[model samples]
Structures are given as C-alpha cells and as structure tokens.
Target chain A: MISVLLIGKGNIATHLFEAFSNLKEIKVTQINSRELDNIPNADITIIAVSDDAIAEVSNKINNNFVVHTSGSFAMTHLKNKTRKGVFYMLQTFTKNKKVDFSKVPFCLEAEDKNDYQLLEKLAKLLSEHNYNIDSEQRKRLHVAAVFVNNFTNHMYKIGNDICKENNIPFKILGPLIDETASKIKTLSPEKAQTGPAIRNDEETIKNHLNLLSENNKEIYKLLTKSIQNGN
Target chain B: MISVLLIGKGNIATHLFEAFSNLKEIKVTQINSRELDNIPNADITIIAVSDDAIAEVSNKINNNFVVHTSGSFAMTHLKNKTRKGVFYMLQTFTKNKKVDFSKVPFCLEAEDKNDYQLLEKLAKLLSEHNYNIDSEQRKRLHVAAVFVNNFTNHMYKIGNDICKENNIPFKILGPLIDETASKIKTLSPEKAQTGPAIRNDEETIKNHLNLLSENNKEIYKLLTKSIQNGN
Candidate 1:
C-alpha cells in the first residue's frame, strides 16, 4: 500500500484527496496549508498549493519523497533537503465538478529515479495517461494550458456577453463550443480553424467588429491579424 | 415526403445534404450554386451559399418557400418573390468532418406563419434541437457564435502554436479544452472562469506575460484586462 500525505485546501488538493482516498491501495492523509508543522510521516508528501505559495509551503515539509503539484513550478522549488519530485496533473479543477481523473494527463518529474518511479506509480493509480516530463517541458505545458483553458473560457465569456446584449440565451452557443473542442482532438487546430479571419471575409469581420465594444474590437482586430498571418 | 432543393457546394450545404439524405421522410436534391437555373421545383428551396451570394442566388428561385442558410444574413436577403424564410444552423462545419446534425441547434425564421411552420417541420426532421428565432435574434446568435466558435477555435490555434514552439504535442491540451467547453453548459462562463486574471494574481499573470511573444503578449494583456474588468 502507498501512504500519501496531501497538503493545501484548494480545488486541486480537494479533488486529489477525494481521488486518492477512493483507491484501496492508497492510504491518503490531507491537511490544510496552515497546519504545516504537524506534518505526518508518509511514503510521499504532495503539496498542491497556489503558484505563489508553492515554495513557501514546500519549505515547511520534511519528508523523504516530497512532490509539489504545479505545472509551472520547477521541482527544485520544493526546497526539501530530502528527495523531491513533481506530480503535476494537467487540468482545470472546479470546486463543484466531479473530475474523472482517468482522463487527465499527469506530468511527473523527480530528482532521483526511485522518486520518479514512486510518483509514476501514484499517477498510474489515478490516471491512465502519464508523461515523464522535465520541469522546462512542464512549464511550457502550463502555458499551453493557459491558452486552451483560460483563454478559451474567456472567449466563452465574450460569447455570453454578446448573447446577453442581444437578449439571447447563451446556451444556444453551447453545442458549437463543444463541437469546436471535439474537432481539435482529431484535427490540428490550424487546420480546424475556420472563421472570417481565416476565410478573409472582410465584410463579415467588419460587421462583427461593429457589434463589439471598444476593448473587444481591439481583441478582434489583433486575433484577426494573427489568424490572417497564420501564426 | 418533403421534397427539398439545396443549392451550394460549400461545407454547410454538403453537410446538410448528407444529413437530410439520411432521413426517409425528406427527399433532398443538392446542386452546385452555378446550376441555379436548373433548380428543380420542390416544397422548399434552400440556398446554402455564401452570405454575399444569398441575395443573387435566391433571386433566381421560383419556389413558394425559399430560405437561405445563414446566421448573419436576414430573411429579407433571400430576395425571392415567393415566401422567404431563414434556416440557420448554429454550429461550425468542416469539409472532412461528419457532423451529427441532431446535436446542432437550428434557428428558423419566416415571413408567413405557414412558411414558419414548414421550416420548423423541416428543422425537426433534420435536428431534435430547433428554435423559432427571428432575423434580429439570429444576427445576434451569429455574432455570439463568432465568439464561441471562431474566437474559441483561435484560442486553440494559439495553444497549438505555443505547444509547437515548446516542442510539446498539442494533443495534450485536448482534455482541458473539452472540460472548459463542457463546464459552460452547466455553469455561466463568468462563474466557471479561473486563472490569474480572475484570481487577481498579478505575479502569475506577469510570469505568463513574460513567457509569451510580443504579439501574444499583446493578446495576453488585452484579454487579461477584459477578464479583469469582468466584461
């Protein structure tokens, strides 16, 4: 059995705790970040905290196998005298949603081969998809994630605002959003991209810009220019 | 059987032809836009051509019930002396992809009540999700779609570019994209929003901006500002 100690009380920590506790082979203990001095002994201590708090929180941990769950942070940020690693899950966790961990990609990195194997084993228990990624690669993955998840959701917000302004239900655009996301699974995003920008439909682009506010018009022009440049 | 004539060789027309052809109750005759003079008489003639071509193409039609498939174009743009209507499917179509029309939302409009009923009946035959939306609402829906479909896909493109530059496989972000899209179905986009901008984490936002290129940096700043303003 693998004994794991999870730190932090954020979305990722809560979800990880629930997921780990559900596994018969894994015995999990979760605690809030403020109670760092009362750290318990475990085979691996995983710190799932905010980016700004990762280094500070990890410094309080005194464990042989200490790993921080952050894609953007390097493994060296753990500041643990003992063995250190990263068990980062590439996902956007919400408080209320039940995440299917099997679908999530786990990016694992460690200072030692044995620690890497331990993180990999733990990742396998939760997810079928795991990658042996270095810190640099993980940082890049996080940036890509910001674009796909954060930026994409911002686009949905813009769509919702437009629907509200026009007195239309925002749910009408839901199917289109799903289809667009699903298409990229099979086709490259560049090839999957279709719009007035890609088609160079200046009239439609002009009309759309007319409907948007000042800030949105700036965004519309910049992204349109980017898409037109094929970058 | 509801005999229909679909004119256009574009993505929308082709997909509509394939979907309508599968139904036993709907008899669809599809022809290229150039063959408008040879248009056969049918219960309804659908001009699924470009927005610019809708006026010129529908003018040639002599059918009693003529409609153009466009979200932005108004029902009056049909220019048919006969009864005119609009059948706008609110979803993106790709040339190689086989779209499941049942999941697509059909926005229907007509000048006459009987013609509206006829369009609604045909929409029901093609899709389970149908809405009785007028030209004004349909125009707003089109703009909303540009945000959700076109703009959202552009985000995917940016993510892909980031992954490519970092030597990472773009498919890794697929699950994140899917989840972001799925969450909006149940929760409002504003509530579902996450990341540095929403959290007001200036530090992480600065780090992300530093990682982005000059053009991407502009986008990052603009979107961050928009999200910060809660617009």
Candidate 2:
C-alpha cells in the first residue's frame, strides 16, 4: 500500500483527496496550508495548492518523493531536498461538482525512474488516462487548457449575456455548446468549424455584428478574421 | 401520418431527413435544392437549404404550409405564397456524423396559429427540447449561438494550434474542453469562469502571452482584457 500526503484545501486539493480516498490500495492524509508544521511522513507528498503557494508549501514538506498538482509549475519548483515530480491533472475542478478522475488526463513528471514509477502508479490509481509529460509539455498543456477551458467559458458568458439582454433563456444554447465540444473529439476544431466567418458570408457577418455590443463586436471581428485567415 | 417535403442536400437537411425518417408517424421526402422544379406536395414543406438559398427555394414550393430551417433568416424570408414559419435547430451539424435530434433545441416561429402548431408538432417529433421562439428571439438565439458554438470552437482551434506548436497532442485538452462546456449547463458561464485573467494574475497571464504567437497574443490580450473588465 502506498501512503500519500496532500497539501492545500482548494478545489484541486479537495477533489484529489476525494478521488484518492476512493482507492483501497492508497492511504492518504490531507492538510490545509496553515497546518504546515504537522506534515506527515508518507511515500509521496503532493502540494495541490495555488500556483503562488506551491513553492512555499513544498518547502515545508520533507518526503522521499514530492509532487505538485500544477500544470504550469515545473517539478523543480518543489525546493525540498528530495525526489520531485509533477502530478498535474489537466482539468478544471468545481467545489460542488464531483469529478470523475478516470476521464481526467493526468500529466506526470519525475526526474528519477523509481520516483516516476511511483508517481505513475499513484496516478493510475486515480485515472487510466495518465501520461508521462515533462515540465515543458505540461506548461504548454496548461496554456492550451486556458484557451479551451477559460476562453471557451468566456464565450459562453458572452452567449449568456446576449441571451439575457434579449430576454431569451440561456439554456437554449446548452445542447449547441455540448455539440461544439463533442465535435472536437472526433473532428479537428479546424474541420468542425462552421460559421459565417468560415463561409465568409459578409452579409450574415454584418448582421451579427450589428446585433453585438461594442466589446463583443471587437471579439466577433477579431475571431472572425482569425477564422477567415484559417488560424 | 404527416407528410413532409424537405428541400436541400446540406448538413442540416440531411440530418433532418434522417431524423424525421426514423419516426413511423412522419413520412419525409428529401429533395436536393437543384430539383426545385419537381417540388412535391406535402402537409408541410421545409426548405432546409443554405440561408442564401432559403428564399429562392421557398419560392418554388406551393405547399399550404412552408417553413425554412435557418437561425439567421426570419420567417418572412420564405417568399412562398403559402403560410410561412421558421424551424431552426440550434445545433451544429456535421456531414458524416449522426446527430440525435432528441437533444437538439428546435426554435419554432410562425405567423399563423395553425402554422405555428404544425411547425411545433414537427419540431416535437424531432426533439423534446423545442421552444416557441419568435423571429426576433430566434435571431438573438442565433447570434448567441455564434458566440457559444462558433467563437467557442475558435478558442478550441487556438488551443489546438498551441498544442501542435508545442508538439503536444491536442487531445490532451479534450477533457478540459468537455468539462468547461458541461459546467455551463448548471452554472451561468459568468459564475463558471476561471483563469489567470479572471483571477487577475498578471504574472501568469504575462507568461502565457509571451509563449503565444503575434496573432494569438492579440487574442489573449483582448480576451484577457475582456475578462478583467468583467465582461
């Protein structure tokens, strides 16, 4: 049985703790950042704190193998004098919603082979979709994630705003949003792309622009231009 | 049994034809737009052609009840001497993929009460998620869809581009994309928003912008600003 120590109490930390707790073979202990002095002795210590708090939290932990659950941070961010690795789950976590770790892509990184195996074993306990990704690749993945998750959510916000302004139910766009995301699984976003921008339907584009607010118009124009330029 | 004539060979028309054909109570006859001269008589004729072809195609059909399936076009765009209505399915249609119209949101509009009921009945046969949306409301829904579907897909395209440039598989971000779309179903997108921009983490935003290309940089900055401004 592998023993694990989880640091922080944020969304990622809470969800990771719940996911780890479900596995019979893994024994896990979770502590908030304030309880740094009581760091438990475990096979692996995971710092699942905020990006700004990762290094500071890692400094307090002294374990044989240390890992962080941050996509942007490098393994070396853990200044602890021990084996370091990253156990970044490429997903967004909400406090109330339960996450199925099995579908989540875990990007694991470690310098030592034994440490890598340990991390991979632990990751496999939580998800079947784990990968051995380096810091560089994980960093790129985080940026790509921001576009897919954060920016994409912003587009939904814009749609909701449009719906609210027109007194239409935002729920009307739910299935369309789901379909848009699902399409990318089978087709490349380039191939799945369909809009006035792709067709270069100037009249429809103009009509849409007329309906949008100034800021939305700017976004619509820029994205339309990007789509038209085949970006 | 209700007899329906579908005009168009495009993605929406084909999918509508397949969806309607599955129902034993509905008999659907699909014809390509090029065969407009041989328009068939039916209880209701639906012109599911391109937005540009909707008017011209509708002009050829002499059915008592005529409708065009377009989100952007108004019901009056159907220039047929017969009764007019709009049947807009608010989902992205791909040529090779089969769409489960049951989950698709159908926005129905008609001037006459009987025509409206006919269109609504047809929509209900395709989807349980039908709405009796007027032309104005449908127009807003269409614009909102552009943001939710088109703009959101562009964000995915950008993410794909970033992953390709970094030599990381774009599929790595699939779960994140799916989760982002799924979250909005329960939470408003504004409340669901998260990222460096939303958190106002200038440092991380700066790092991301530095890694992006010139065109991507512009989008990143614009979207970041939009997010920061609470739009």
Candidate 3:
C-alpha cells in the first residue's frame, strides 16, 4: 500500500481526501497547517495548499517525496523536496459534493523516472475515470479552462439575470444552453457558432441591442463585434 | 382533436412538428414558405417565422385565429389582422431534436377574451411540463437569454478555443462549467463571480495573458476589465 500525506483542507484537498480514503491500496493522512503536530511521515507527501503557501510549507517538510497541487505554479516551488512533482487535478473543485476524480484529469509531474512511475500508477488508478496530464500541459489547459468554464458560466449567469428581469422563465433557455455545450463535443466551436452576431444580421443584432440594459448592451456590442470579426 | 396549421419550417417549426406529431389530441399541418401551396385551413394557425417575416406572413393568412411565435415582436405586429394573437415559445429550438415543451415555457398573448382563454388553455396543455409566461415578461426574458444562453455559450466557445491552442483538454473544465451554471440557479452572477480577474490577482492575470494567443489576449483583457469594473 502506498502511504500518502496530504497538506491542506481546501476544496481540492477535501476531494482528494475522500478519494484517497476510499482507495483500498492507498494509506492517506491529512496535515492541517494550523496543527502541524498531527503530520505523519509517509511515502508521498502532497502539498495541496494555496499557491502562495507552497514554498513555505514545502520547506517545512523534511526529505519526503513532495508534490504540490497547482496548475499555475511551477514544480520548482517545492525546492526543498527530494522526490519532487506535481499532483494537480486539472479540474475545478467545490466543497459540498464529492467529485468523481476517477473521471477528472490528473496532471502528474515528477523529475525522476521512479517517482514519475509511482505518481503515474496512482494517477492511473484514479484514471480509470480521470485523465492523467502533466505540468506543462496542465498550465495551458488551466488557462483554456478559465475561458470555457469560468467565463462561459458567467455568461449563463448574465442570461439568467436577464430572464429574471424580463419575467421570462430562465427554463426557456435550458435546451439551448445544453445544446450549446453538447455541440462543442462533436464540432469545433468556431464551426458550431450561430447567432445574429455570427450571421452578421445587423438588423436582428440592432433589435436585440435595443432591448438590452446599458451594461448588457455594452457586452452585447463588444461580443457581437468580436464574433463578427472572427476574433 | 385540435387542427393546427403550423407555419414556417425553421428551427422552432421543425421541432414543433416532431413534438406535436406524437400527440393524439392535436393534428398539426406544417407549412414551410416553400410548401405554401399546402397551407391548411385549421382551428388555429401558428406563424413560426423569423421576426422580420412575422408581419408579412400574418397579413397573408385570411380569417383564422393566427398567432405569431415571436418573443421580442409585440402583438401590434399582428395589429391589422382580425383574430390575432401570439403563441411564442420562450425556449431555444434546434433542428436535430424535439424538446419537451411541457417543461419549457409558452408565452401567450391575445386581444380577444375567448381567443385568450383558448390560447391560455393551449399554452397550459403544452406547459404541463414547462412554464407559462406573459408576453411582456417573456420579451424581457428573451433579452436576458441573449445574455445568459447566447452570450455565455459564446464565451465557452472562446475559452474552448484557448484550450485547443494550448494543448489542454477542454474537458478538464467540465466541473467548473457545470458548477458555474448550477451556482447561478441559487445565486446572483455578480455575487458568484470568482477568478483572478475578479480578485485582481495581477500576477496570475499577467501570467494568463502571457499564455493567451493575441486574439484571446485581447478578449481576456477586455472581459477582465469589464468584469472588474462591472461595466
């Protein structure tokens, strides 16, 4: 059994805790930075803290296989570590519900081949459902993720608010919302894009704009122009 | 059985054809402009044409309780005609599938009391699984949908492109995407917004900008500024 030590109690760490707890072949222990006395020596020590806390905490742990769980942070952030790597889950995390890490993509980064092999095996176990990625790729992926997930969801929020203001049931847009998401799976977004803006239907665009509040109107104008010019 | 004459063969009409086809209580005769020769005289005629075409088509139909399926276009668009009303489906429709309109929303608008009751009954029947909205409210909702459904989905597309170029599997953002969507159902978008741009994490934001393509960089900057300034 691979013994793992986790440091942190945030969303990602919590999910990791639950996942590791259920794993039959892994023995995992969590360390609270606030109560460092509980920390135990283990085969793998994972620093799943905030980006700012990585270096300070990495320095505290003496000579264990250390890995940090961050996509944006460089692996060198764990400089004091002997067995150094990254165990970044390339997906967002939330606290209330359990995440299916099995399907989640794991971005594994390690300097030594043996360490890489160990993390790879651990990642693969999770990979029965999750994806196994690496640091360099994880950074790129994280950047893209912000665009699709974070930014897109924001747009949905805007849509919901607009519906509420107009007294149109937000449910009216559900199918379109779901379809927009599903289409990207089969087609490149560029190819699947459709709307007054993309069609350059200035009349419809103008009508839609006239209907918008000042703030929404600004967003509408900007996005319309962007999509029209193919930016 | 209600004999319904369905006009237009665009996205909404095509789906309506598929959905209404299975209902035993309703007999639908669909008319694409190309199939105008077969326009059936029936109890009700639903003009499911483009916004610009609503007036022209309403003028062509003679002495039937005619309703145009448009959210933004007011009832006045059908003003000159007798026995006029609006049967707007407040949901987005695509050509590939039939959505369960019972759970969707149907916005009913009519001038005459008896026709209004009939329209309301029809709407109630369809909305057994959907929502019922008033025209004024639906128009407002349609505007909001422009923000949430159309605008948000476009942002997702843009974000996905960023991932594609960066060799990141866009799938990684699925959880975040779903969470963002699900969150707004319970919270206002402005309150739920989280990210480097919102927090003004200058270091991370700068790092992200460096990673983006020139076009995406421009988008990142524009949207980031918009979100930050609440413009």
Candidate 4:
C-alpha cells in the first residue's frame, strides 16, 4: 500500500484528500499545517500549501519522496529532503464540482532517476483518472491557462456588469457565448477570431467604447487595442 | 408579402438570409455592394455589413425601410431618406453551425411609428424563432457580449495555447472550462470567482508569472493585478 501524507486542507487539498482516500492500495493522511503534529508519518509527503509557504512547509517534513502539488513551481522547491517531486494537477478545480481525474493531466517532476521512477509509477496509478505531465511543459501550459480561464472569466464578469447597467437580459448573450467557445474546438483561435477590433471597424469600436462605463471604457480600449495588435 | 432586401454576404447576413427566407410573408433578396446598382427596390433592407460600413451602405440604398443588423450601432447610422431602423440579431453567428433565431433576441429601432410597427411585426415573426430586443437594450447587451463572447473565447484560446506549449492535450482542460462557464447559469460570477489571484496569494501569483514565457508573464501579471484590483 502507498501511504501518503497530505498537508493543507483547502480547496485543492480537499480534492486531493477525497481522491486519494477513495483509492484502494493508497492510504492518505491529511493534515492542516496549523495542526501538523497530528499528521501520521508516511512514505510520500505531499505539501499543498500556498507558494510562499512551500519552502517553510518543505523544511518541516522529514521523509523520503516528498512532493508539492503546484504546476508552475520546480521540484527544487522541495530540495531540503532526500526524495523530492511534483504532482501538479493541471485543471481548474472547484469544491462543488466532481472532476474526473482520468481526464486531468498530472504534471510530474523529480530531482533524480529513482524519485522520478517512483513518482512516475504513482502518476501512472493516478493516470487511471489523469494524464501524466512534465514540468517544463506544464509551466508553459500554466501561463496559457491564465489567459484563457482566469482572464476570460473576468471578462464575463465585466459583461454581466454591462448587461445590468443597460437593462438587457444577459441571458440573451448565452447562445452566442457557447458558440464562440465551441468554434475554437474545431478551428484555431486566430481563424475563429471576429468582431469590431479584428474587423478594424473603428466606428463600431468607438461606439462600443462610448457605451462603456468610464473605467470599463479604459479596459475596453486596452483590450480592443490589444486585440487589434493581434496579441 | 414583405420584400426583405439583404445587403452584405457576411456571417450575420447569411444567417439572416436563411431565417428571413423561410418566413411565409417574407421574400429575401441578397445583394453584395460590388453589385449594388442591380438590386431591386424592397419594403425592407437589412444592412448586415461591418459596423464601419453600416453608414456608408445605408447611404447607397435608393429607397426602402433600411435596417442595420448590428447591436452596437444606433438606427441613426442608417441615413436613408425613407424609413430606417436597426434589425440587430443579438446572437453570435458561425459559418459552420445552424442557429434557430426564433428565440434569439432581435433589437428593433426606427424613426417613425409606422416603420417601428413594421419592425415590431417583423420582430414578432422572428419571435417564433427567437426573442425580441430593443435598440438601447441591445447596445447594453452588445457591450456585455464583448465580455462573455469575445473576451471569454480569447481566454479559451489562451488556455489552448498554454496546453499546446506544455505538451499537454488541451482536451484535458475542456471539461473544466465548460463547467466554469456553466456555473454562472446558477451562480453570479462575483460569487463564482476562484483561482490563485482571487485568493490574494501573492506567492502563487509570482510563481505563476515566473513560469510563463516572457510575453505571457506580462499578460499574467496584468490580469492578476486586474482581478486583484476588482476590475
């Protein structure tokens, strides 16, 4: 059986706890760092703390095969230990939704061959629910995710505000929104791109800016200019 | 029978052609500006051109109840001597897919009461296929659309690019992306917001920024700051 010690009990940690606890041949001992003394010793110590606390949490663990669950960070973040690795799950997770790990990609990294082999075996086991990933590639992916998921969601919020201000039913835009995302699944975004900025329709763009709230107008102009520049 | 003269052969115009052509009382005629002088006179002219071209195209029409199929632009853009209005379809149109405009919102605008009534009748005909919208409401919805449709799609593209750079299958992120958008159906985005930046985890944000490519790093930082600032 693989004994796993999980540190932190927040959103990501909770999911990891639930996932690992449900698996056979895997025993997970979850610990809130605030209550670390209660945690049982284990073969693999997985630190799931915030990035600033990674080094601090890493030093507290005295075990082989210590790892951290973060996509952007390196295995070196766990350098104080003998066995160090990464088990970063590259998917946006929420507490309410049940994610199928089988489709999630686990970005894996380690300091040495033995540790790499051990982490790879664990990753393969997890791969029953996720695809195995590598660090360098995952780093690039993390960046792209920022653009697509985080920034895009923010735009949605902005759009909602616009709708509320204009007495328009935001639901009216739902079908169009779904179609926009669906198109890119089959076409590259560069080809799928449309609208005033891409069309270079200055009049419409100007009119759109005019309709925006003063602050949003600034954001609209910035984004429009960015889109126009093709970045 | 209503003689509907469709101008411009773009995405929106094509969809309008299919929808209006199917109506019992509507006879649709599509004309490209390249062959402008050849078009026959009609009761209604739908100028489904780019926003910048709406004014120019409306000026060329000989005589008719002209309408521009743009949500952002006002009916004033249609400088036609005869009746003028906006027949804006408040939905995103793609070339590959079929859309049912019966429930899709149609924004109606006109100078004269008779012309407005004519559009209202036309809108009622479309209501069988979609929803009816007015000019001011549609403009607000259009701005909101920039966030939901255009901005969100761009974000997905970013996520795809991130996955591509990391040697990870972008498909892995698809389910999560879909869920994020779907969550809003029940919850407001303000309450639904998640991720490292929203948590105010400066360390994670810094690490994520460092993980990105130089250009992407700047984008990540800007967006992270924006989210943090609540913009």
Off by over 4 Å in 1: none
Residue A75 C-alpha lDDT in model 2: 82
How do the candidates score on chain B by TM-score? Answer: 0.96, 0.96, 0.86, 0.87
| Model no. 3, DockQ | 0.49
Please write out the lDDT profile of model 3 over residues B86-134, one tens digit for every residue. 8877555555755767656666777788887777776666675335455
**Per-residue lDDT for A46-123 in model 2, tens only?**
888888888887787778888988878888768888889998888988878999888999888999999889988988
Give the candidate number with the greatest lDDT.
Answer: 2
What value does the lDDT take at residue A93 in candidate 3? 59
Interface RMSD of 2: 0.9
lDDT of 3 by residue, A1-231 (tens): 899998898877878888889989999888786666546888788888878788888887774688988878888768664778888776655547557666566777788888887887887767643445666667777677777656765676667667666655566676556656665665666776766777777876777777776866767887877788776
lDDT of 4 at A33: 74
**Docking outcome class, model 2:** high
True contacts kept of each: 0.83, 0.92, 0.53, 0.56
Candidate 4 lDDT over B1-231, as tens digits, reads 778888898888888888888898998889896577776888888888877677887887876688888777777657777777777776777785777776576667777778877877877877743445566777777778877776676667667766766677877666556666776666777767877789887766776776665655655676677788887
Determine which window of 10 residues in candidate 1 chain A has minimal summed lDDT. Answer: A139-148
> Model 3: which docking level applies?
medium
DockQ of the candidate models in sequence: 0.82, 0.87, 0.49, 0.49
Q: Give per-residue lDDT, candidate 4, residue B28.
A: 83
* Candidate 3 chain A, run of 10 with poorest lDDT: A127-136
The full ranking of all candidates by lDDT, starting with the best, is 2, 1, 4, 3
Judge the docking of candidate 4 as incorrect, acceptable, medium or high: medium
Better of 1 and 2 by TM-score: 1
Q: Residues B150-210, candidate 2, lDDT per residue (tens digit)?
A: 9899999999998888788888888899899899888888989888999999889988888
Candidate 1 residue-wise lDDT, A122-182, digit = tens: 9999888888888888887787787788888988988888888877778778789889889
